[model samples]
Target: MVSQSAFAFICCLSLLLTFAHCKTLKRDVKALNEIKASLGWRVVFAWVGDDPCGDGDLPPWSGVTCSSQGDYRVVTELELYAVSIVGPFPTAVTNLLDLTRLDLHNNKLTCPIPTEIGRLKRLRTLNLRWNKLQDVIPPEIGELKRLTNLYLSFNNFKWEIPKELANLPELRYLYLHENRFTGKIPAELGNLPNLRHLDVSNNHLVGTIRELIRVEGSFPSLRNLYLNNNYLTGGIPAQLANLTNLEILYLSYNKLSGTIPSGLVHISKLTYLYLTNTSKALGLMERARLSLFKHFPYQAEYHLVPYLGRPLLRTNHSATLPHLTSSRPNMWRFSLWRFFTR
Candidate 1:
């Protein structure tokens, strides 16, 4: 029953496997240690010891997430969100080459995002929102070909929104709102076929909204588009009606002029259309038509009512149109209720 030769061979193979495992584990441990040190290790005291990946299914560190890769486990995610970790962008993350999700949102991290972030080619979700980080976004971020969700909102980031972001073919959600970002929205962004939610609202953006319509099937899958509280000018594009899946459209507090596109009513899925205080130039007749659509599903807020210092449709007065008077009394009440409440 005791075959020394086979037993020795098995033992040797086991040692080799252990060695390989240690090599991979050590690399991740070193990187994590560096991150802890950079962010002040006292804050992440739970990240103690040399094995951040832990012994079995659980990780030794608080925010570390690992997955088995052959004989060894590798760190795949590091969610240190809202942990009060302060300092510059933790450059040590670049060392975790296998990391797929890096969420450090709501931190006190400062300085520009490191270009070394590009090395994490496997990153899918990078959530750095609500941080104190500043400076322009690194163009190297476009190197993350597999990225899907990128949230850099509510930061102090300035300069033009990076056109390089168009390189992410897999991107779905991109939030860069409430930043100091200026310049026109990148026309290249409209080319992303799978992008579903894009919010660049409350920035200093200017120029015509036409940049987004440069591509034929622009924002083909977009659902919620927020471009409000900016200095954007020119008419609302009729092509926007092509976003048949769009549900919430916010174009308020801008200098947009010209007739409200009639094609907008055709977007049957649209539920919320916010055009409050857009421009005084919008035709009163056109505004009245938008407010009175019988089939319009959700509340629509136009600049026509109180902002223009008069009621758009005075159903009680002689000024009420023949069409308005002839309409079912219930339909008129319903339309007025939705318009005024908004």
Candidate 2:
């Protein structure tokens, strides 16, 4: 009795598999309605109509996340930071081929950043910081080799600093500070051996911090090297005491000169040393008999105290201070909790 041509051949194979699952959920709802009409459609994209990946009764759109795949959905994650999405940066958001996290940092975004965004090869974390993004950082974003954390700070980018970001072999936190960038600084970013916190401080970068620590193993897991207020001059590079896991060394207001390098105060992991705004343009004297605290190998390491002036007169009161005044003890104003409690 059930042979009406085998139930009309199982109803034409369940209507051709539900018309190919509504044609892959209507092509991920037409690429999320072309990124909500290229980021101009507000009212939170009007609840992105027509069942956007939340069918069991419909819910998903707003900041759009969607998941499933074989059954439908798609658009992985589009955070949309700061709401007020103005325009420009929406190159149809690389058409959501399973986007991995494209947070459009602090909106009001202007132009530039579209070198087709290195086609987002599953981008890791690319927050376009404080937008208004001007030209030149797209050396195809080093083709996002699964980028780690690239926040283009303050924006209005002026170019230069892109030595193809050393092909991002898993880049770790690279914020291009205060943008208006100029030349030098790119000693291939010390070949990014998993760079850790490298801020190109206050740009107008001039060079000669010996291309940043003369490049040996270079920034080997660097811990916070800001290169303060650029226009940088010479003389702080005793290979920066080879950044022995440096801990906060800003190099304040640049135009740096000599002295301060007694192997950089024995970098037993310095705790905040800004080089006293370059001791009044390196007039840092006291080298006649060469004893920057006898290169501290320990004599209780000169009673370790001065961070802003007071305790360091113990080589038996080191001949009663005053070798070049400026009120002595300015080992660049210490006190970063006395180098992590001794």
Poorest stretch of ten by lDDT in candidate 2 = 333-342
Per-residue lDDT of model 2, residues 201-253, tens digit only: 98898878876667677878778888777888877778877778777878666
lDDT of each: 0.78, 0.69
lDDT of model 1 at position 210? 72
The residue pairs found clashing in candidate 1 are none
Candidate 1 per-residue C-alpha lDDT over 221-324 given as tens digits, one digit per residue, 9 for 90 to 100? 89999998899998878888888888788887788777667688677767677776664454455455645443343333323343444565543332233333
TM-score of 1: 0.81
- Backbone clash total, candidate 2: 2
**Model 1 RMSD vs true structure:** 7.3
